[model samples]
Target: MSTYEASLASAAAFMERHERFLVINHVNPDGDATGSLLGTGWLLRQLGKQAVLVNEGSTPEKFGFLPGAEQIINASRAEKPEFDAVITCDCADFARIGDVKEWLPLGMPLLNIDHHPTNDLFGTDNLVRTDAAATAEVLYDLLTYMKQPIPQEMAVCLYTGLLTDTGGFRYSNTTPHVMEMASALLACGVEPAPIAERMLETITKAHVRLLQRALQTLVLRDTDQTAYLTITAADMEQCGAQNDDTEGLVNYARNIEGVEVGILYKEVASDKVKVSLRSRSIVDVAAIAQSIGGGGHVRAAGCTVHGTLADAKQIVEQKVSAALASQEASV
Candidate 1:
């Protein structure tokens, strides 16, 4: 059997020993987190095991259509459901569990399933594949090994996660293996068009307005190669937009012909700014995020700064500029 098969067998055997499971994802979960959670939850239910999803925050409005989304309980509000084991999907580190960390019992078995190279392997059983394009790919293998059937709705959830996380297969991480996995999911009646439309093509008027406003603040530094945008709390209020509306704004900056990196700084709450970074080539945005107390992959990463938007933006831009300048000089 292949390594994936072996890992799947191991994970399945472990699950078979557990009666109750608490599932969790990282804070500010994206498509990968939600999709993997839903897919895994479906598989767990098929095995006749009790599973509960605990997320750090509310699912984005755009992804509310995913099946089993309503079953997710915010970790902060949950009454601490008792579980024999804990499973975290798509999270690199323990801190990413946010408030859900409080619910896990000490000395209890924890399973960490992820695709990030930065994963800490904090669980009793860890299956982190750095080569997988998305965590959904790993989940697909797990479901197969467990002899669980992938229903149409489960296919939708997995497909949605796979598509968005890989940037519709345009990202560098989209390998032939990922394409094969996508094909397998497609065989389960996955449709690409509507999924793309709903996740990427569809946009609300307020979201459009917010994008325009955020774009208007775009700034290019270091010979117009690094472009970024900043959105203050006032900007969100002015556009009547929520945090989810700014989801893909950083891509806009990264797509610019001369830009090497794109950054979006948004006021998430009082005295805190959420920063998203994207890099076209060469630059490792994850390193930048790590320097700012956040972590992700090389191409995409995010972190939050505990300061006013202006202060956070200034710090990020300055640090990013220095990093780009060093990269250029090295080249």
Candidate 2:
């Protein structure tokens, strides 16, 4: 059997062997992260397995439309349940799961279902397929292998994952297999237009103001091949914006003409900055992120650095500039 087939079989066996499970994703849960966590939980429930969906952070209001999102409890709110296994979706590293790490049973089997190229392979039974486009895609394959019927609710959740991770099928990772899975989910009674509208088109006034502030800091570097933006804590305070409001602001930088890479630096703490990276064509932002203790896919990645916003920006800009130079030289 192929590697993916073998991994699926192992994952299915692991799930079957366990009774109670704790499903988790990254801290700042996005559509893909939230969708995968909820989707996997719903699937396990269909199999009569007890699954508790937990996150270190709360679900954003934008994803309230998802079927099982309301059921997801924050890690702080969750009781210490007797969990037989732990499954993480979309999170590339254990640290991304935040406080949920402390809640897992010691030495319990972990099923790492993810698509990030920078995955740390931290699970006992890893089903990390970097080519899958989204962790929800990996879950869909696992469900099919286990002969579980995809319910409408699961379909909606998985479709949301595929839709958001691929930027609504606009990103380069939107492969034919991704489209096939999306089509299958659609056949399971998911409406794409509504999901797209809810995820992409609906933006709050605070988000608009945050975008405005971010755009004001947009800077072109590396001879205009790189575009970067910033969002200080002051900007968030002035606009009444939370981290959720800055979700897609990095795209504005990436969409600039002649720019191959985009970067967003957000001051998350007084002495720390969170950096999001996106690349258009050749630059592998994932490698750059991994080098600095972060992980993600080729086109999109992120990492946090300890320093002032100015210091973080200078460090990241130098790294990105070197990566660009290396790519150009190799070409």
Candidate 3:
């Protein structure tokens, strides 16, 4: 067996060894995180395991159609539950799961399933497949490896994970294998057009309004090949947009021709800003994010800066500008 196959076998054995599971994903859950969380929860329950799915926040409205999404609880660190093991999906590190660890029993076995290259291997049995396009992709492999059947609901959740994480199959990570997994998911009764429309084409009033305000703050660094935008707390308040509404806003900058790097600065508080970065090709945005105590994939990454929005913008601009320059120099 290959290394990934061996890891899959081991992870399957680990799952088979446990009966009760606590499932979780990262904070500020995205499509991949939420999809994998819901899919895994469904899989566990299907196997007659006692699984409690929890997230740091409520599932995004777009994903409410996902099967078992309503089952995800917004848990507190104070609620200690009995679990044989913890199954983390789409979380790069334990901290990304937020403070839910505080409620977990000390030294409880953790099975980390993720696709990020920056994964910490923090789980007792780590099944971190960085080469896979999404955690759902990894889960598909696991399901096949274990000879498990996929129901239509589980397929919807898994397909959503693959769809969003691959940027609707537009990102570089969309390989033939990724496409094959998606085909298999579709064969399992996932209606492709509807899911895509709901996730991509559908938008709320708050989203477009917030986009208008954020775009009004657009700034371009012509020399560095970067385009940027910012969303202030005031803008979000005025538009009544939640954090999820800002999901794909950064793509507005990255999608522009000639723009190599796109940045979004979201003011979470007066003294705190969340920075999202996207690069067309040349820049390793994840490394830039990691330099500022954040982490993510190569073309896309994010970090939270503890400073005023202006300070955060300055810090992120400096980082990406330097990175662009450095990569250009090396070339």
Summed backbone clashes in each candidate are: 0, 0, 0
Error of 3 at 113 (Å): 0.4
Q: Residue 209 deviation, candidate 2, in Å? A: 0.6
**Model 2 whole-model lDDT (C-alpha atoms):** 0.90
lDDT winner among the candidates? Answer: 2
lDDT of 3 by residue, 28-144 (tens): 898889989987887787678899899877777888898888888888633666888999999887888887877777799999999998887999998889989999999988899
Candidate 1 lDDT (Cα, 0 to 1) = 0.85
Model 3 TM-score, 2 decimals = 0.96
Q: Report lDDT (Cα) of residue 117, candidate 2.
A: 85
The models' CA-based lDDT, in order, is 0.85, 0.90, 0.88
lDDT of 2 by residue, 1-331 (tens): 9998999999988888899998989998999999999988987887789998988878899999999889999878767777889999998988999988888767789999998888889998899998888998998999888888888999999999999999989998899989999999999999989999999799999999999888889899888999999999898899999779999999899999999999999998889999999999999999988888887888999999998998888888888999999998998
The residue pairs in collision within model 1 are none
How do the residues 1-331 of candidate 1 rate in per-residue lDDT, one tens digit apiece?
A: 8776777777897788898999998887888899999887887888889999888788777778888899998877658887899889999889999878877778889888998866778899887787788889888778766677788899988988899889888899998888988898899998888888898788787778878888788888878878888787888888888767788888888899989889888887779999999998888888888888888899998888999888887888887888888897998
Clashing pairs in 2: none
Leading candidate by TM-score: 2
Q: What lDDT score is found at residue 75 in candidate 3?
A: 84
